[model samples]
Target: MDQPAIPRPRGRPRRFNPEAAVATAQRLFHARGYDAVSVADITAALGINPPSFYAAFGSKAGLYKQVLERYAHTGVVPFRELLRSDRPVADALAELLEQAARLYAADPETTGCLVLEGTRCIDAEAREAARNFHLAKEEALRGFIAARHPEAAGRLTSFVSTTMAGLSAMARNGYGLERLLASAEVASCAIREVLSTSEEHPS
Candidate 1:
């Protein structure tokens, strides 16, 4: 009599890499947004089973949090480097906006800022996760502006953040790089004007 064969346990594949899974999930989430990409979709994309997905990432939101971190580290604009103290505030800030315009439209498949798009996701947990990154970036912008132009820091930071949000949304809507760059140029002009006015008024 033949012995009965035991079935293999259901779980992540032996070669499964959590970091690679996060990168794959980042692509799906970036292309489709958080609400649109389900756990099954992620698993399928990563060639894993539901059990494996759950074992690797506690939930969809948990995976999204990791994706967000990866995007922040690898995909996001290097604000710290761009907002250097050596450069004039207006010039550096203008360059930041211009760089954002370029970045937002860099990828046709993964258009727009990932963290910005995540902020509008339907899931509360995912939305909050994205908002945290957005808030942190805003704080960094405020800090950079406050260092040189304390009086206009809040207003300038708000203006830049709002403009970047608009750029991200436009990029998601299929706006090309040239159009975004034009819009960013207008924003740059506005920033320069604000800084000039602040210096003249000195209050």
Candidate 2:
């Protein structure tokens, strides 16, 4: 019998290398600011040429947006579930802060929240997207409370989400795990106190 034939080299790939490239883009953008990261830097990280990178990600801005979008959506759904959980909103927020701290501690390089980083160098359109994203997060949180505790929805959503926003930003600013936990603890305590106050004084 004749030996099995070897596959011939195809001029172009049948499948675009988006997965590896996109992951690489995300990593690079997190490592270097978007404006600071050159296309060559991305190509080197991905081990692809500029043409291939462009083919896979379109443009630098486009690639950054895709990466940022992925990072933003990572735990959002599960996080929403936590918001709707019966564990008490304050406890749920505490859990989220712990998770965020662990995530950053595990790999500070890949785990810096991209949406926060992306806002630094983007144009008006991208800034608008970020604003809309925060608005949606706030709204989802409000709906979560409204569905479960209609009477206290407005105040709880505003305060808890604000605390979370501050903690998230603090974590991104390179706070140590201990510092992060302490910050979360403070937020949790405040949440609990506010809840106790609200319960005591029903309006």
Candidate 3:
């Protein structure tokens, strides 16, 4: 006698790549911010259920941290390279700001630096996560400047960091590329003046 027919599996099987999931989460987090996107939202985006999501990332925060890691690598401008160049500090910094403007406005949907936006996230752990990277960039700039203009190092580093935040905010606020570039040009001029005065005082 023929055996009873076996039952077919239920709805669509979970179809998502763990690596691809991180990228998808990155887009969502970048566009909507961390607190705004829910575990359910990620699960839906990844085409997986809550159980699968937990298995893959542990939690929403865990996924966000992973996304942050990916974004930190790919999303921001590579200032470290510019800072390392033998070019004069003022010139390197001007290029750095110009690159920042381009990166921040590269995508209208995900305008702004991911880490900067994460600093405002509701979760304390996430905020600390972002802060670590932010502070590292600041320290790198400070060291580069201190090597040449020690007196102006702290002040100029602060200036660059503040200007970067403003650029990110403007990009997110729908400022076009031209406008962002204009802002960066003004910042570059400020950098030149700062360097000029630092050279004049030499203390």
Better of 1 and 3 by TM-score: 1
TM-score, candidate number 3: 0.88
| Candidates' C-alpha lDDT | 0.90, 0.65, 0.87
Among all candidates shown, the one with the greatest lDDT:
1
Deviation of model 2 at 13, angstroms: 2.2
lDDT of 3 by residue, 100-121 (tens): 9999999889998899988888
Residue pairs clashing in model 1 are: none
TM-score of each: 0.91, 0.75, 0.88
* lDDT by residue (tens digit), candidate 1, 1-203: 99899988896355578888899999999998889988879888999888778877889999999999999889998998998777788898889989999999999999999999999989999999999999999999888888779999999999999999999999999999999999999999999998988752222
Please give the lDDT score for candidate 1: 0.90
**Clash totals in order:** 0, 0, 0
